[model samples]
Target: MHAEGADAADDARAALLAATGAATLDDAVIIARGRPRLDGGEPAGPVWKVRSTRGLDQEVSRLAKSRGVSKSQILREAAAAYVEAS
Candidate 1:
């Protein structure tokens, strides 16, 4: 009876792994966030969050749309520009 229970538990575990698309416990544990890199390079560094007014948020969105880039890209370029100006 003990051996039968162990086999049933093993079967349940295999079914769970199949359902979650993870082959092992380690594969099921990892959590990755953010956009994946297209260059096959390392992921981006730490994230920076900023609070913005509604007007400023709209302006940044407009600028980003005009330049065909993401708001994050715009922010990065703006930071570089500030460093250069300083």
Candidate 2:
């Protein structure tokens, strides 16, 4: 690695360790973006991706209009339906 790149990585590691040690439990977890699932339900399954924004918007809008719902809500429901179908 380049000297500057190595230095930057070292700096980032040092900062992370410092934050983990200095933070409260909740704050530290939040800082690390760590979300631990509980036993009341199974862990969330793997997330899928939508490739094209335009296609996604069109589909969501169509579903929303058919369902008489808002576009954003329709998008979410469509995604959930897809996951279930898969």
C-alpha lDDT of all candidate models, in order: 0.67, 0.61
Q: Which residue pairs show backbone clashes in model 1?
A: none
Model 2 is weakest, by summed lDDT over 10 consecutive residues, at: 22-31
Q: Report the lDDT tens digits of candidate 2 across residue range 1-86.
A: 99999999778767875755423444444546643453357976565565668977788767654444456455566677999999
Query: TM-score of predicted model 2?
Result: 0.33
Off by over 4 Å in 1: 1-40
TM-score list, all predictions: 0.51, 0.33
List the candidate 2 regions with Cα displacement exceeding 4 Å.
Answer: 22-33, 40-86
Best by TM-score: 1
Question: For residues 1-86, could you state the per-residue lDDT of candidate 1 as single tens digits?
Answer: 59999999889777655654455744433311233463488766778999999998889988765554467877888888999999
Candidate number achieving the greatest lDDT relative to the actual structure: 1
Candidate 1 minimal-lDDT segment of 10 residues:
27-36
